[model samples]
Target: MPARARLCATVPALLPSSEADLPEVFGLPGRRLLAQRGDSALVVQALDDALVPSGGSVRVPAPWPRRRGTWAVAPDASLAVFAGVHAVRAVEPSGATRWEVRHGCWYGACRELHESYEEYADSKDHRYPEGGSAGFSVDGTFVWAHVRGPLAAGELGPDVVDEWLLLDATDGRVLGRADAGAAAAGSFHLPHPSDPRQMGLSIGEGQDGAPLRWGRWDGRTLAVEYVEGDLTLMSVSPSGERLMTVTHDQDALAVRDTGGSVLEGLEWAAGTAVPRHPDAEPDNDEALPYWDWAGGFVDETTLVGSTVEGDEEWGEGRHWIIDTSGARTPVEVTYPVTVGPQPPTALGDGTWITPAKSGEALYVWALD
Candidate 1:
């Protein structure tokens, strides 16, 4: 049976202050929207219960181009941090650099401590260099960053290629550090909702493996626990007790406890949970559905997911709502209008956001 999804709001993408590029919208844990444009500026806006913008968007200057690396804004939207190829810089809205910490180069073989982006900005080797990411804690006091190893001279070790550092968000002071023990092509951070001391790190090593790490700071020391090797951490539940993850192969989705114990898991079987594509030939063995890499908890007991990638070859992608504590069955979600093939992103509220076909707006959906 199909469940009806209600249309909450059709929020237009934020107009960019920069020239030429379309703005991108990111849905944060809180009911907030961070619309970023080019590498020139960022606009943070809040959403009301109806999923509409609540007030004026706070625009801040981006420290570098968008293609450089990933970044995060503080919870209060007062500051923005850029995790660049050679340094992690904090920038204020007035385009002032509050502080910066230079680290080992993201380029695999380079060892020079670069003082500026211009040195290798045009180099062919640095064009596609692997990089790290940063995010601010919920309280906006601490910043958790995953970067290439060896913060300063003589700190390098044979096995330490990547390090996760905890920094003071205000002064950019390094408080604690831990060796991530992985050669990452890229990485990201997930902040704990209530506790500013704990955060999650997910690292991707291309076709090699996916590693999940959980970190905690005790105000004196930093401790990181290896969670799992083959799973990509998706969403943390509302109560902060459960986690949602999809297998690296996208074959299974599992609900696990905070300590990394699987509570419930479901796999895609054509005729059982996910239906066979109607456009596929009756005898075609190539038509199989796999889960998308995104999606999160709609609530503690239920979640919204999709088989968009697997469904793309046949036609429009499909979405679903899964019950975590019940029979673990998935019910297809039907929308009033057509949505793009991109995966649906759950807002951690009661709704989720999907991009418009034209890429100029976002539509928020909720179970009716």
Candidate 2:
């Protein structure tokens, strides 16, 4: 049976002040406008519905000196902002420091894990000068960071090797380290949603090893599990029973059992191209490619995605609601590209919230 959708509410026309990119909208229910102003990198939280700050805004102090990488919010609504070269800083809800670590990789030639609680109230906590990046667990109890191989500045090519370190959240302690040696490409990290202790590290083409590797941490021992295919993105279902992933080679979205068995595959519809604007010039490449299935289960068998067609001038991206019950045509939600991220909290409400790309604005949509 197809799940019914409702038109809840639309909070449209909330605009930002500057050119914003990388908008992360969290569904805090009553919480509105938790976004970053691109120009200032100011993490603002709006308390009231009136988008403009009549209610006032709080500025998140930058964790690192450099502006790169992304930020993640914990279930408790605390913020973890990543400064590429600087360590990951954990900010409390009351705007105080919970903890901070100065992280580094071997290739980067920096050493020392600087930990700070209330001590360095002024200075940021620093980690070892290795090339590894950090990821927080779902509960924010752990951080899994990967560091690349040793090399002087500009000397390390794409193929440089690296290591993965699992750290303790209470205090910045290296719980375990794994040898992730020489690879031909850049690596991306995906922490497993089901098992907070494990993470998937993907080393793209540059590496000489398998394209996909899943690392599992069992308290005292850490293990690396391999998967077949060029994995693009890996996310666990809200229920944590299934694994959802997209591959680089094909547009098909695959779902696997949490134990690593293939459950089903949904191929992108071929003729269903991105709709082009009426006044746009005709071109073969106009159909924007549908890539990156940022999917989460709508039900046990249904998944929803915010997809963009390859064509540059076509439609604002389209929403694909895929049904995996058997074989079926996925239902789609087509709207203006201005629609921010797809519904942040999928509680079967049929309504999703997307923050504007600039992080200045937010849009709420209810499926028709």
Candidate 3:
């Protein structure tokens, strides 16, 4: 049977200062939400009784002027890294600087990390933007960082290559490094929940979404794993038993073992049954469906899928719970209330977060 969803709690979301892009959700182990938008962010957490800092706590500032790159909070929520165009700077929760690594500019034309956002954006060599990202290990011992290959002037040279490094969080020492030989238009870091030495890097290839690079650091060596085609890694199961992703072009959702073998899969293009809905289309509701680029496995046995926009039947993009464990088929999750537009951020513990920034709150929905 399909699972029933309940609005268990409501919390504030980190809204951008002005008219800006939607915030990105970073799960901070203790049911916290790091809704980061551009250069600054707010960390709102789910507490035992209610979501934390109802008014939004201190702002996590970016090293640069505007939010041109990505940022991540350490596991303890004590430190944050600003992976700006020129360098990666780690700062404490109180805004005190810990360490900074000056590197090459991801934007080729830029000579250095400018304090002015316009100077870097307008003077960039490539039309597409370039930036870096960093994340702390699950145990907080190491920091996995990605940046445009370092240069003396912070600008890309004749032959620039992207670099990924494993750093010692305590001293900013490079533990391991690899050169990503792609001219990536953009990139971000997807953290592994269980392992401290492993993480995933997704690099954008312009019109072709992005390709993922799986990295593992075993004290001495850093292994960069790639399948050479479209296997954009999305959600790494909570137990680390498998990885789930919607294939290139959002054609199919494929689950793979850690060793890189397909276990079970589902393609949305194949006509899916319209779960009985009161507001479904009049007739011929069954049609080709597309999976959201962001949904994930609700648990070991269930996969929660979503779409950018829902049809007349599912309302504004339906959230489907599929029994990928093979014992049963997919079920359309029934929500007790109206859900918002952005894809659901699966917490992997029978709970997920739906951020309705426009509504100025986050809906923490639990499955029953």
At residue 153, give the lDDT of candidate 1. 40
**TM-score (C-alpha) between model 3 and the true structure:** 0.82
* Candidate 2 per-residue C-alpha lDDT over 32-146 given as tens digits, one digit per residue, 9 for 90 to 100: 4455535434455553443233354455554543224445455334555453443555665465666654543332433423333233224333233223356666556777765
Model 3 bad stretches (over 4 Å): 1-3, 14-34, 38-46, 49-56, 108-128, 151-160, 265-287, 309-315, 326-328, 357-359
Clashing pairs in 1: none
Q: Candidate 1: where are CA atoms >4 Å away?
A: 16-31, 153-156, 264-272
Computed on alpha carbons, the lDDT of every model, listed in order, comes to 0.79, 0.50, 0.66
Error of 3 at 51 (Å): 4.6
| Residue 170 local lDDT, model 1 | 91
Question: For model 3, what is the error of residue 248's alpha carbon versus the real structure, in angstroms, after optimal superposition?
Answer: 2.3
Instruction: Tell me how candidate 1 scores on lDDT.
Output: 0.79
lDDT of 3 by residue, 26-54 (tens): 55345454454544443433243344543
> What TM-scores do the predictions have?
0.92, 0.65, 0.82
Choose the strongest candidate by TM-score: 1
Scored by lDDT, the top model is 1
Give per-residue lDDT, candidate 2, residue 157: 38
Query: lDDT, candidate 3, residue 139?
Result: 73
Per-residue C-alpha lDDT of model 1 across residues 85-158, encoded as one tens digit per residue:
98899988788899898888999989878889889989998888889999888788999999897776445476
